[model samples]
Target: MSSFLGRGWSFPPRFDPRTKEAVMVADETDIAESLHILFSTNPGERVMLPNYGCDLRRMVFEEANEQTVTEIKELMRKAILFYEPRIVLNRIEAQLVDPLNGKLEIALDYTVRGTNSRHNLVYPFYLHQATHPVRA
Candidate 1:
């Protein structure tokens, strides 16, 4: 029986060159991978899927504050709701790790659709200035 029998099909299906077998991902691991991809990809980076990806990167360039945190949460909500059909968001929180350095931490709580399983994930991102001064 294929390893993918009970587990759902893996996204971005990979294959082992040596064994010539498809790599299978299931459950939490697969969801985590999907979330990572969702967070890492910048919007408009995907050719045909222009609306895909999160705006978290853009938020890094902005000043980190209460408003920024709220914006981040909202962006997360919108992006997740629109992109991931397999999970439903339960809560999202964002806090400034260092306002001066434009570092922020985000926490997301979600439940997999069709199942009662719940999961939480935290992500850290740094937004640096577009231009930096050169010290002599």
Candidate 2:
């Protein structure tokens, strides 16, 4: 039953040094990695599955205020609900890290369906000006 939590290519798609094959991730790591991809990708970014990802980019130009935070939370919920079925999402907290620059941190609380293992994942969402480089 828990095997339904699948195995997939590692995020950033690295290769094994010895075998020169693509690295893979399994179980909870795979799920977490997939979530990272989901949050990073924009909906319609994929040609084959046009709606496969989260649409956080839709609000790229929106102010990182409460309303934008709420909408982003909904986007996360929708993406997880539609694309990932291995876990049940319990709560999502989208907090503004820096509103002026459009940075947000989304915290997710979820449980795996088969074994009831609890997990927490924090996904960082940001826009182009979200951070400032320090100059000494």
The C-alpha TM-scores of every prediction are: 0.74, 0.87
Give the Å error, residue 112, model 2. 1.1
Model 2 TM-score on a 0 to 1 scale: 0.87
How many steric overlaps are in each model, in order?
A: 0, 0
> Candidate 2: how many backbone clashes?
0
Off by over 4 Å in 2: 127-136
lDDT of 2 by residue, 14-99 (tens): 89999999999888988988888887777788999998998766677677678888888998899999988988999999888786
Q: Which window of 10 residues has the lowest lDDT sum in candidate 2?
A: 127-136
- Which residue pairs overlap in candidate 2's backbone? none
